[model samples]
Target: MPTVRLPVPSGDVWARTDYETLPDDLPVRVSLVHGNLVLNARRRPVHQRIARRLATCIEDAAPDAWQVDMDVDVLLDDDELEPSEIAPDIVVYSAEHDLYERPIPADLVALVVEVVSPSTKRKDRRIQPTLYAEAQIRHYWRVETDQTAPAFAIYTYELDDATGEYVATGVHHDRLTTTVPFDLDVELKTVREP
Candidate 1:
């Protein structure tokens, strides 16, 4: 991936307005985290492979009413100055919504998956899950990849409506089978294959 310049915001914090108004042709990739504009680095090939594979599997199994999208921002808040907008590795949302919409609202999102990377381990494991739960997204999956091989550990969580938090539903190693949002069964190791 080639480098591209990130836009500079006038205020100390990068507001939602700044991110929303970026040039259409800008080559950079970024995500707004708690009011900060986080410039994303190019992902490792293994990371990309896993994300693409999981997305494909999810889309194949998705029902007619649902759609799968990758690296798209899901709006968790609308505050102009301190909004929280996160772009998960993969998102499963309602098909009724327009795909071109700038940010997919949290309400329409049924599931968000994060393929953990060294740089994003903390955020993916802790911060992101918290934000998704707070937004009431029904399901979440954290994929832990072993750089040495195709081995993976997939952890699935379902929102506990009463506590406004996620409760562990399953911890998968060889296969990921889930029955929320829709039924899905993915052979976890296939994610690393060419």
Candidate 2:
């Protein structure tokens, strides 16, 4: 097998349209951040496990008007020159959206979750939260996996309209309970089950 190099558009910065033209079969996950192309290797098994199980839990508790999906792009800024698009581990969005749409608009998103991994620690904890907050997404949850007794910890945040930033609302170690994205409760350990 040979390495496939991404075809870069001739421009000062990569735009949303440029990103859309990239081959879907590319081996890595690519995102447009600050007008640059950022590549991330495939997620680890534990990362995928946490995302999948947690998404199921959220979907079960979500209201009839909202839906849950994993590893789908959310378009934060649709600027022609320097658009920003990112895929979260899990996204809770309006059911009214078209089913065939790619890069779901940020405004349509109710909540976004990221299961932190070694590869995504800085982006998940710092960069992504800022982007989601700036886009005014209502809720953000970061799941930090641990090798210790707790297994995982979920840090929840809500958008602060006054400052346009996320304010940490709660941190749950064993169980997660929240009412903002609709009343929901789940045992964090379920994400680690075999």
Top-scoring candidate (TM-score): 2
Q: Write the per-residue lDDT of candidate 2 for residues 1-194, one digit (tens) a residue.
A: 78888887769999787888999888889899877899987998878988999999999999899999999999998877778899999999999988798989999999999988877888999999999998889999998887422557889999988999999999998889889899999987787665
Q: State the lDDT of candidate 1 residue by residue for 1-194, as single tens digits.
A: 67666678878887888888876665656788778887666688878889999999999999999999889889987777778888899999999889778699999999999999888888889998998998899999998888532666888999998999999998899888878889988887787566
Model 1 poorest ten-residue lDDT run: 143-152
How accurate locally, in lDDT, is each candidate?
Answer: 0.86, 0.89
Candidate 2: which stretches are off by over 4 Å?
147-151
What lDDT score is found at residue 22 in candidate 2? Answer: 95
Q: Which residue pairs show collisions in model 1?
A: none
